[model samples]
Target: MYYGSVGGNATFLLNLPPDKRGLIHENDRARLSELGEAIRNTFRTNLAEGSSAQASGTMSGHQVDSIFDGNPDTYWCPEEGTEQVTIEVDLKAETEFNLVVLQEHRYSQRIEKLELEVQQDGEWKPLWIGTVVGYKRICWFDKVTSRYIRFKITESRWCPRISVFEVFCG
Candidate 1:
């Protein structure tokens, strides 16, 4: 019975008290973890291929479009007095994305925490909440639609500024 069960590629091992039912051993648990990883990798997809980004406020020389200019040195810094800033991205066409990549100014810790939202049916819905992100942050969540991606900065370390180099959705 052990030989047949061990090599049968079974996903679940039943444990019963009446007949000393088999309990999944280390090998079986390892196999299950591998299976789960394979499933996640198989369906992962990037949905933010050609989206355009926009911001709520910009500084004197730092414009909102700087984040998408494909230059690391150029970044978008929010205007003063706008304590809470937002950066919204228009996906052009509706799509599904489960990952968000935020690239901050090389070594700045200005952005301490932020929230991500998506537009659905003309209303904005919360998607993900990011915290303790210094330079770069990759946020992952269950697949959601990408009509309008909004990144709101709620907490900051200093300067009341929202500085970001690039933001990617996938």
Candidate 2:
């Protein structure tokens, strides 16, 4: 449920059976905790960190290269009047990854739709299309081995302000 819902960009409801006392079974609780820990361990490292990052167009203060700094306060924004833009991340070498994390600054959510693509064999191939990133969105797909990845913002309420973009292997 967690992987499907998160990867498909939908909210999910996980149900765990509870007893008459409104307490979950011991086994179920333990399993749930184990799953949570596994997920945490999988994403503990951001493989895209410190990779070369650049945007099609960049706003002065909100330079796109800062997206990997890990600070939620600083963000990357495209030039004014630009509703669509692309940010390319160079992994420095071929990297294998299956998950991506996107975060929007807390002030507002402007992104309406975006697509992720990978450069394979000198060609760009689509991976996933995401919608409405409010605070944070976690997307996962089949593992991809590539040196270059692109984040294309197709639709937005305005110039999209992105705080963090990260990639993880899972």
Candidate 3:
């Protein structure tokens, strides 16, 4: 499988073909390199403004907790306060997809909540939700059919801080 670290505190899982999977253990160097390229491309396209580094750079733990305190539309939660961050995605086919969200707590000992949503009938609906403890990572998967996708961060104690958030699609 190809895993990407982006978009949230999760790993985006991309299932590889049988041949590719078989080579992972015996030829991990080449397999990992290919996987890295795929992940980079995925982030380049899905992140806001087609810039993953830029998007990530704008957020911190303080930013996340105070997002609503400022302009909700333009303000970003601090990487530490980012209860959850998501991206709206356009998929060509309906399939089971998986991704990981990694949360790095700057002060808090645990994440309050993390979630994913899909646009439905002009509304954003929840597709999945979970919790993370300490400074750890979590994984989630679901079958979805949508042209647009977004990540939702619900609750956190800190104000800002994040190392990275990426997405992987298949």
Candidate 4:
């Protein structure tokens, strides 16, 4: 609910009903706490944070390596008019992740279609495909361990600019 709500540009609200004594039910309180812990555990660390990033094309001043620097101000943009480009991330070690979160620069053109791939046995295999990445897109796939993964922008209104590229398990 948290990811789906935020990813779709909405706020999530969970209404808790209290007992006749005006105290929140223990079951409800416990469940809510569990939900909070689950979310925290899933996103506690980004598997790709501070790792190496490479792209097929890049515009001046927007280096691909800045994607995981934890800064939203900077972004990676492809060369002018480059419709199709691929961004690859090196986690430095085989790590398992099932979720990919991508956020576009605030002012860049929207990405229409993007695909995720993982390298296995020297071959790149497709994992997930997404569309309409207006501001953020979350692709959830089966958990897999890999040292390398890549995101390809197949269609965009213009050159796609990515401000945040994150990978996680959950």
User: In candidate 1, which residue pairs clash?
Assistant: none
Better of 1 and 3 by lDDT: 1
For model 4, the local distance difference test gives 0.85
Candidate 2, residues 1-170: lDDT per residue as tens digits?
67666544456667777988899988888988998899899989999888888899999999886789988789999888889999999989999999888877776678899999999999999998978776777878899999999999999987888888999998
lDDT score at residue 41, model 2, on the 0-100 scale: 95
| lDDT scores in order | 0.63, 0.86, 0.45, 0.85
Taking the tens digit of each residue's C-alpha lDDT, what string does model 4 give over 48-110? 886898898899999998788888899889888888999889999999999988888885547
Model 2 per-residue lDDT at 32: 85
Model 1: residues >4 Å from true position, as ranges? 1-50, 159-170
lDDT of 1 by residue, 126-169 (tens): 99886655555666678887678898988775533333332333
Query: Can you give the TM-score per candidate against the true fold?
Result: 0.64, 0.88, 0.41, 0.85
Per-residue lDDT of candidate 3, residues 1-170 (tens digit): 33223334345565544464455454656767876887566544322122212223234333432221222233334344444444344443332345534445344344566566766667887776765533435355665555444554465556323333433443
Residue 21, candidate 3: alpha-carbon lDDT: 46
Error of 3 at 6 (Å): 15
Q: Which ten residues in a row have the lowest lDDT in candidate 4?
A: 3-12
Clashes of 4: 0
Residue 96 Cα positional deviation in candidate 3, in Å, after optimal superposition: 7.8
| Total clashes for model 1 | 0
Better of 1 and 2 by lDDT: 2
Compare candidates 2 and 4 on TM-score and give the better one. Answer: 2
Instruction: Count clashing residue pairs per candidate.
Output: 0, 0, 44, 0
